[model samples]
Target: MFVKTMRDDKLSLLLTLIFSALCLLTAYRSMSMIAEVLLFIVLGIVYFKKSSIKEELNQREKLFIFAFIGFFVSALTSWIVGSGWELRSVRNPSMPSLIDLDLPSKYLLGALVFLLCVRLKWCLSPKVFGYAIGLGAMVNGCIAIYQHYQLGYSRVYGWSGIAEMAEASALLAVLNLVLFVFASCKKERIFYFVAIFLACLACIFSGTRGSILGFVVTFLFVGVMIFWKKRELLPIFFVGVLAGGLAFVPSLTLEQRQDTMRFDSAENDLKQYMQGNAHTSIGMRFEMWKEAIVMFQMAPFFGLTSAEIEKKMPEILQRSGSALVGIKKANPNNDARGKKHNQILNQAAKKGIVGVIALLLVWFASFRLFTPFLNTSGNSLIFSFCGVSILFYLIFPSLVGEPWESNVTLPLVTLLICAFYKIQKGQKIGY
Candidate 1:
């Protein structure tokens, strides 16, 4: 009996480690998800007879699990109807999407791991996690900034395959600044401020329009909250300095400072090249949205299947404008190629009414979870900013970008849900 108990304990520890690693690594392969689920089962069985599950769950814990379940259910519903039509008449059968299956699997496994953490009282403090992520962002942002300057040997290097991934990560670093500035810890505000400033520096240099737009909206929302809360203006001032310092850097050898948004000028010649060589950058997004609308009109019910999306874009582009007729032959943004850029439009095209409704419900549920914190005192200011920042992403990301399946979007959603759950509990039940 002693030996058996020891072995069980070791297995449980191993499972816990595996789950944490999966979360950190963002592994979404089917095999990885299955292995994670099986390990969870093993741990569950080993602990089943030893302790009462009911005793482990509290109201706060229940809220977290329910919120995640709610998110998952919506995603699953969208996927089922969305993918079902395509699966009915398989043609090639060899090139099925690993992502289609892996996305849902990852969400389910992540929810399970998160719930287990809450139940086991292993939840990493948001402050710590936020700080660590913020620090990483600052470093990455600095590197991107260096790269922008075309610094010789001193430039920051990233894997060529994953440079775009840095875009979202850098944005998250900016959000962390917002998170930390609003946090109640009361002592680390200066450190967080510096981190956010560094992130902003990187943003100016990266020349990514998506991150730039996201940051502006996030900042405005955060600005309003800070002002309303009657908080000291010192931190905000520091942020201004950081942004200014990076923007006006005279030492930067790159021509980035000269290009600043004047896409039509000789100094910013890349914009013209983009316009001529790649009709599909931001320009293609506009055409795609119009095409997506026409698609919705054709299939108003369940929308278009994934296969249809894959098949139809070429014809749609031809009808909209031909390459011979002043239109570029190729799109610059690869993510926009298979997607409609707008999530709602994509849903309307992909799953019809069901997909659109499920997505609406998700937004509504997210807002509802965080509403209590919006009106309450104490951390109300910070929570309110965070809520708005998240909403901004939801509304805009779909409008002109397709970051729906990235690692950044999922965690940002989960973070909002977790915060809402915590604030709700702290109010009625007490933390």
Candidate 2:
């Protein structure tokens, strides 16, 4: 059945569309287990088809190879650390068992499934890829509005831990907005503009500072590309979009404004700690990062075993003196209690220097694959936008949350990275 779908391009397109819609709806409904399972099933079916093996190892595949290496290494190290080191000295040894089961499994599954799709060329098209992400953003955006309707403020709406879901939705919104703007470059369609506008609007409501910054950086990148190509009229077109984008800012609720404003402030408790206050979330993250760096410094080569780091957390927290009593009170979901906001720092803390090195290699690999298109002179606007969008999203979000772990953004980044190479190389494979 899946093979039949693969053979029919029309069916493949339809599957992509339906899957896109399902992704968005899942966000709104908060059906993540179902969403993950359904996506896996669909991806599985697409790969099961024994189609043209020659088509498998295209530019897209090569790009994925780079990201896959990084993703695989990160997961492998995380699993090793989470299972061997982090779990060693836990209070209720069984508690570690649950983390060992869920955390690594999701990463492993996502990595394998994405690799299989690239091998099968499933969900590889720029158009379909854009639609899928756009749909997902649309769903989350609707969910944010819905949350505001029910609870009076916008927050993440899915099974993904609140921070992860919010970041993922924000990242996707940035990507979708870029694609939507690029799409506008070719044709003038009101529906396209409206849909993209709504998606960007949702991104604003998400209150994710990283995504907002990512969107701004993406626009700047687009401007550079347009200028490089001497496309003079693009600015007027973009300003119109910017105007529309700005119009929605004042629409945010008071609660939404307050929560999201923390994102804009550089004066979090960290500033107070530097002066003398000592009790800010920023200070805690700084403490975690410093302790992590010390652990890495001590075990620079093999890195501190995850077990060692886990055992040292209490001691580290105590020494840093960044502890707070009611810190957990700010969270409504209760899941935000213990997460380091930096992906790089998290990797260092868990996998030490070795993990950090592996992650850098993965970033290099992904960037290397896309370098060809970025430097090329053809109409690879979609591909260029994808690369820039991922770059900005990762860089900006690293300050806000550790999204590289278990969030949909990681795969989306990989997918876009793969799509850039695939679209460029696929064109030469003779249709």
Candidate 3:
């Protein structure tokens, strides 16, 4: 009986422990890799609990799982094609590989978390799960504040890059708000509220405009969900007004002095870039997107190998009427270090048609996983809200930045998605 109890205790802690460590460890090291290792450990333990996973899988869950598998498989297939059919991890990005299996492949490990959540729902603790994310965000927030004031860094990236810091914090802030709303007591509420504030501070300090877009989208999503629930136009109208005003938040890196919004000069930055000054923050991304489009056209079906993509840069740069002339002047060897800043374009350019289809499949299945839950009420509705919120949080920012490529963002997104994937089937009510 004691051994059984101890085993159950470990099972209860599986998700919480891994995710809590992720929020803390990812800032210092390569979290996706760490998470992969930890997930396999959990898998080994789960191998013993095969009897407990008696819940029959549904069609949607099955489809999502398959789609997830297909996405990674397609990427691997492309990598094989790019690596001349080599089956090993291609460490050199400038080498012949089509996909960067080094980090992006770890995204597949998220399937373990999803499956565990579905099978071991009985052992999971929502409070522990919620608070872990909240505390993690709060800690990062505190560090960002310290970096901003004491360390004298222009943008407080903490240990991660400014993009990762801003993007991830803004996402956590919104998710933490859901926790704040559903807290049973003052202590939980205080913890989540402080977490929300600090996370937002980190977002602002990191100053990624994409996080601001996340804020606007989140506000609009809330308003829409509210109206969808209450079926009232008046509340939605007010929410729209609030959302419009709140649009003043979220931006990418556009300044050296301030990490947050640079609305006053954002227009100027674009105008200058249009006039052959492609050094602005927005300009660099826009230029890359344009070149990436050209890259995609060159290899429309299977896409180019990373080496081939790098090879094409000289021709794109040397074109007589190319917009990249300023980029060349700004950084003569600016091949974007062989990466397109946009996720859609980057995937399309590097992995081609198969890659694009894989991406779409992953998005569709994942989003569909939470749609049915959103129609629920009470705590279930709140649960779905956070789940869907985390989804959009990943989706929007990823359009501009490759969260998959980041050391922390992919693991962060994956764990958050799995964390919010509440076990909704025939569970006991807990209001």
Candidate 4:
């Protein structure tokens, strides 16, 4: 019995280490996938060893799991009914040609992870996870800063060489926000403070307007919440702000600052769109959103397939006189380049109202879990931060991209939710 218990503990430790690595190494999708597969294998073994499959879960957990499963089912149904197989090549001929199928599979994987964590009690130590994520953010942040120095401040990509600058910046911003909250709650950890500073530098250098806005908004909200509970920390917050501003001053050139602020005026963006100029970043997104809404209207319930969207986009553009003059004039074959930047619209375009409902349920369930710990103490504070971090990801991404489809964002979110659930259930996380 002693030997068996020790073996189980060792297995648990190994799982935690892999999970931590996944949190940090998300820039490499292949690596993250391999780690996730290994984790699932270990979880399967643990599940089989249990005397019974029954495990106690709160209502929120159950709802989240159900919503996740619903999302997968709805996505799969859309793929099948919408005849996704026939249009796979036209959608993306370069890859294996089953992008829609892959998305549903990913969703199922997340659901399984949530179930295993709840049933087998596989929640790892939050402190360990936080440190791992912080370290990862610091490394990525350093890379971004270096890139800005080496490649100029046009746009900086971190270790995630293939991902867009905005996507990478957004991920770092969310991770850094969590670290900031952890540092505030712990108060003694200089590691998190340094991590936050590095992350801020990365955000500034990346030159992604949405990411910068998200980081500022999230931290401002966190600061207010922290100060509401403990007003004495106000001075510390200001000092940190001063330090961050000083550190970032060198990189914040007039051109770079203006580039970041280019999309600030909504009225100007609309004017650019009305003039049929999709060259501007904000203008392109507005045009895409309009196209996405049209696609959603075509099949309000089940959604049009990727092939159908591809087939119809030209007609829609031609009819609306919004042919994305910049893209069309430059490369006629690449007219299908723009994507629905907003998550809700993206889902509505791909899987229709069913997909939208499932996503909404997932968001609702997430908040349901976190709402209780909003004003709690001790470990609950950390859990609340985790909740808020997830909320930020959900909210901020809807403005510019489909964050739910991201390999890094969704899995990390699942792991964090599971960890917080374990804490809420009074399970002692092993260090």
Candidate 5:
């Protein structure tokens, strides 16, 4: 019995270590992918070791799960109905067949990870999980700062493969928010302050306008939550402001900051787009959104395939007499021009109104789950802030870009949600 108990404890420790590694390696896509595979295997072993585990999902969790299922069903329907029914790519005939499967498969994998966390709650620690995420963000932040200042790169990317500076900035901003909340709720730690400073520096250097906006919004949200609970905590807020300002000052001198702050350019792009020009960045997004709306109108149920969308774009643009026609004609394989930049519209175009509904339901369920913990103190408050940070990350970036499509953010968010739920339920989680 003693030996069996010792073995079980060792398995639990191994699971915790894997979870930590997952958080630490999030910025590196390849490494994080390997960590996730290991996490699943470890979670499976732990799950099977615990005999006759009871279902522990609350009403909100159940709803979230059901909404995810709804999304899967709708997406699958669209894939089946639209696949092989559209024009084949002359350059790459086998491409469209596998690409459409990306979103659904990602969502399924995320759901699996969430479920495993929920099931094997005993093998997790919320404190360790939070620290792991902060440490990961800190590493990425340091790399980004070095890339921008030392390497003289215009936009810092910090080992986040294929993700743009904006995406990395948004990620660091969200992580910083989580660390701030954790710091406020617990005893002051130098590590938390260092992590937060690095994250802020990275965010500023990355020079992503949308992420900066998201950070401000998240900061306000955290401020309100913290102040509402303890009025005397106002000093901490001031200190954070001072620290963040000092950290961000150096980034303000970067030439990239000017480019990032060009709201006038974005406005001009929109004006150009309205005047039948779609060549600019903001203008191209406007064109894509318009095209997505038209696609949704034509096939309200299970919208057009990528092939159909690409094949039909020329006719559509020519009919509208938009400048996108010339652009599309010059570069027929410009998939970015064809895809929707907004997440909600993108989901609607891909899986129709049903997908939209499912997406909203999932958000609603997450909010429902998070709302209760807001009024609590101690660890619950920490969990609440983490939950709110994830929500902000999900909703804010999805408006301008497909944040969830990344393997890093979604998986990390799901794992954190599981850990937060365990904490909320008063489960004693240890590293």
Candidate 6:
């Protein structure tokens, strides 16, 4: 699939496009599973075909490898401690079963698959990659519109969990705007502009305030990059796109849906909480974070697993006293997700300090990986902009929910990470 022949390059490009198309659209978020199977096949082909393998590990790749290793180890140790050193635990959909490392492992596995793809030169060109992402976001935007207006849904989830959908919408918006900056042709440029509007609409319709936060941060990042690049005239046009994005929410027919974007009531939500009214969304999240703190205190190093966390909840809540009671009231049925509105806090309680460090390392390593492209040109410029800005969508939404740990999100991050590396490689490989 390398550039030995034009035919090989075309097939590689086609395959890459197909792979990119599968992101975030299917049940169980099967992209990672499919990537695992492909990686196994690639490994066997490399072993049997007597092909000489050659690729050096850069600082970015090495850091990513360590981060994922730490993440997997954290998950394993947490499960081990939670199981009481037992080899296996009872099966529960919301809990880890015996040897069940799939959650964290899938993230590492997805990265490996993309690394192999780059090694074989089976990756899209920067222009095509932009289109692939833009097209996917377009489809998701359509789905969001259909679900939000026609179906009378409160928000648009698009076959993913609420957090995943929120993160995706924000990510789609950010990337589309970035793509508009580095677009290769006039048609692509125009389409990317439209993508930005759709993506912003997705953000509004998602009703996840964190997505809006991410979008605003990314929008500013894009503007700064544009201004820094000395493309002074373009920022004026970009501002127009920003206005179109803001118009999406006002067009909504329902006041309640529009209220989702209003942060003015946040203070009121807090004041109500102080009066023992913890039903507001903001109040519930604050209370859940407090509970997570208690859980983390109980098992700071190894952390409790989901099952252990559940078993010890009553004891932890009793100790919490009247300082917090939203968790119990919000989840009388004791739903598995009662105490995890904030992803970082939830990680602290369940995975302990070890898992938390692993999570932070992944973010830090990714920061180092993409920011260097800031001084580049042509297609590689997309990497610098979209890659760094994408982290906002990944991390900000996780502040309010579990986007970072989502099946949909992990694979999407891995695929984009691979694309960034390979696009840089392609620059050297004759793109």
Q: Highest lDDT: give the candidate number.
A: 6
Supply the TM-score for candidate 1.
0.67
TM-score of each: 0.67, 0.75, 0.82, 0.83, 0.86, 0.85
Per-candidate RMSD vs. true structure? Answer: 7.1, 5.2, 4.9, 4.2, 3.7, 3.7
Candidate 6 whole-model C-alpha lDDT, 0 to 1: 0.67
Q: Global lDDT for candidate 4?
A: 0.65
Candidate 6, superposed: residue stretches over 4 Å from native:
1-6, 23-50, 84-100, 229-237, 240-268, 322-339, 429-431
The models' CA-based lDDT, in order, is 0.50, 0.54, 0.64, 0.65, 0.65, 0.67
Give the higher-lDDT candidate: 4 or 5: 4
Query: What is the full ranking by TM-score, best candidate first?
Result: 5, 6, 4, 3, 2, 1
Error of 5 at 269 (Å): 4.0
- Candidate 6 per-residue C-alpha lDDT over 6-120 given as tens digits, one digit per residue, 9 for 90 to 100: 3555545455644566543422246545655665475447634645644566777777777877788788888877773332334554543443365677756755665555456
> What TM-score would you give candidate 4 relative to the actual structure?
0.83
RMSD of 4: 4.2
lDDT of 4 at 207: 64
Model 4 clash pairs are: none
Candidate 3, residue 179: Cα displacement in angstroms equals 2.1
RMSD of 1: 7.1
User: 1 or 6, which is superior by lDDT?
Assistant: 6
**For candidate 1, lDDT tens digit of each residue in 129-212?**
455545655665666566655663222333321213334444454456566665555556666666666665555454445655
In the predicted model 2, the residue pairs found to clash are: 60-422, 85-306, 85-307, 86-306, 86-307
The 10-residue segment with the lowest total lDDT in model 5: 161-170
Identify the superior model by TM-score, candidate 1 or candidate 2. 2
Q: Where does candidate 3 clash, by residue pair?
A: 207-259, 208-251, 208-252, 209-251, 209-252, 212-250
